[model samples]
Target: MGRNTRKRRMPLATKVTAGAAALALGGGGLVWANFYASAHEDGGHNRTKSRGAQVATINCPDVGQKLTKVPRKARRGVAKELALLDRQITDAYTRLAETRQAQAGDANYVDNAILGPLKSKRTATLDRIGININRAGGTAPRDLGRFARCQGVPVDQPGDGDGGGQNQGGGQDDGSGQDNGGGQDNGGQAQNGPVADDFINIEDVQPNSRNLPNGLAANGDGGSTGSFTTECGTNENALRNSDNVIVAPGVSNGAQHQHDYVGNQANTAFASDEDLANGETTCRNQGDRSTYFWPVLRIQDGTQDIDQGRPGGGQDGNVGKIVAPTAAELRFVGNRTSDVVAMPRALRIITGDAKAFTNGLNNANTAWSCTGFEDRQVTDKYPICPEGSSVVRTSAFQSCWDGQNIDSANHRTHVDFVEADGTCSNGFQAIPQLQVRLVYDNIPAPRIENGQVVNPFAVDSFPEQLHKPITDHNDFINFFDEDLMNQMVECINSGQDCQ
Candidate 1:
């Protein structure tokens, strides 16, 4: 848990307080679960749609010795800011590697756990970088700002020669042969297109089926509400649960739902041209008139490691019991409710397979009886179970059942990845007052030198580690086009440059 230190530079007044501090507003506020709007609403999703099916290129910005010789016109103040930003980026990489290493031993790490920390660090770095850009008299890095509101920000610059996009390049190979740690500067101009065509309308999906409550069955207990305490605490405190835990609805059988939530209730998700595009969103529900802030709530599990995630006899057929702990396992465990913990349920067609949905979510899930964080057992006061025992995450993000990468034409309305930096404009400003959709993209398929796609599953397949694409959107249809389709095929055939 890294703490932020606001260094005392020149007089606070000396810091540029010009139009919009260029910092992403909304310091630390909780957003509802309709997290898909932020990215899709602004330029991120616009980029996806305007490209019209072009392969997404992942690029790292230039960070070589170029910094050693700061631009002659670059302000001295801006220079220092850039230097600080540089160190922060390096630190982010280190932290990301550490998180990955911690989970390296776990077989069930395929859910992009390692990337979680990386994303957080990336967001922070993006924020700092955006500030530097504004201080340097540069226009905002439009992409960064859009991401901050939704998916979070990105650090590296656009990829080299990939049409104004960042390339994931590390610096030169030393004599000893270590790749120096700077990104390359391609200096390519960002692609320009008709600005009017950048976005898709999300209103068409109003009363989206994803909003219905299937994970929390109707027969179950009603959902509960509460607040978390990441606000008044240190970094360490922010790492664990500081709120009340919620139990799964009684009708849920303490498991995740397998099929779509409300999609079948009515086919509101795919009614118009605007509904079929791509976009990005953070976890704020603008569509529903609810009071919930976050889409998911995760109560920490104190146990270090639990037995391989296999449940025993229970009302669901397994006898609930506890197990041991592992070093990688964090603290707290709990459940969720439709009113509070809302995530876009992957399935939309009900097809009367309720049993299939339930079983799929609870598969091999263990209980919270064995090891409890602080020896605390699961209770109504804290809907989460103790570590090593029967446990559930109180939020949608933490639930095993909440995650599925379904992007068929019907499922993927709009989706985009938002970086946390303030460079990109916020979706709120772009679309103002609308419901949004969000999704995460798994690592693209591996590739050959010629940039052809390789089988992701064949490359590496661990149920816990299986990767899939997660796209976010307000208007879902903005992402498709001949360019994008061709690029997607190219990316799958050759993962080299595609994200």
Candidate 2:
């Protein structure tokens, strides 16, 4: 049986709420609402408590056993390192509290500079502790306990035998001075301390560099310039899965956060490349069924904060949640002299690297700015929004395609951006450029934390740990309906401004 001939289970249509209303067919349609609240109240999804609800403690199981098993000669060094690690963990907690207190008024600053570095420092320390422990011929424990005391709890618990505070569930201390079980420990509540095998060691992967011929200047022919816009409803089933076939597809544990998807109603973590190519679409024009996705931007909202502290922290907080943007602005920019060719089916393109968040640079296409303050562009770092303004994330994909290869080995080599002269490079065909602008409605009333105003808006990545708010990444799959795509091509080639 052929692939399309086989009967396939149709994916369920996503349930929409005030946050994600039906896609309005028009230019710049906006939908603003409390996405978190709407999902919890109307979407039947259970929301987790903010990290503040969880208590922090330092408890490692089998420490005694592991210590005893170590060789006598190396025991002393291991013991010394372990003690140092304990102190370092405590210090990390102290620093975190102090930073939070200092930057409570500026949540964006806290996440961008203060919290992320602190988490990385703690992770490095943990990695050292694990190395020393392993060197002593002992295996390290998985749950090392929280690194700091919970709010309202004393830093030093007097009655607690292990020196750590009471566990979230109020479980009795397990002789080891750590609560063995009870209330769920919010992953973001404590730092995991980096392990030796942590995934951070992987280097940023880039597409093979290609030298292409430059195409004609954008308006060299003096043809009038034109553009078109497509608006689609955001999917609420935003999930973080390791199933990326574009970058590091062989690695199943890619860390990610919630992604807001448009176009194919069935687009999801489990959706395969073939599925997207063949799936039904939710776009206004039935023929324009290409899948578009990007990380969902979320606001702190006071009730819950962003977490990206744990090793798998990417999936820790706000997993399976969706924060719909006011509207997804899809505009095509191209030469007025030439009509754009319909995007080939199953063509995969990735703009901005998610892993680049750690280094804070490398990807140049990612851009951030305040909605009204477009002149001020921010990269890698988030800009503070004035009382009246909101945060905006803008991503532009490469517009030149090889016209032959649907995909490249690096997932980007097949595509290139138009030159300053507006011509395709290396014989690559110039297509209508797709630019996405996502606007986040700032919290009407900023939450007061420690007597300071905390901006609620945050990018979907690990804000507290990664620190790179500009790691704004986006993905696109062209499964456009043949006729609609042709219309878009006609509009662009004819130099007609289209809606």
Question: Best-fitting candidate, measured by lDDT?
Answer: 2
Local accuracy of candidate 2 as per-residue lDDT tens digits, 49-124: 2322221221111122122234434434544443333334344434443443344445354344534554465556
Cα RMSD for candidates in order: 25.8, 19.8
TM-score against truth, every candidate: 0.17, 0.52
- RMSD over all Cα atoms, model 2: 19.8
Model 1 scores a C-alpha lDDT of: 0.20
**Residue 294 alpha-carbon offset, candidate 1, angstroms:** 21
Q: Give the best candidate by TM-score.
A: 2
Candidate 2 Cα errors over 4 Å, as ranges: 1-224, 236-245, 248-255, 301-322, 336-339, 442-456, 462-465
lDDT of each: 0.20, 0.44
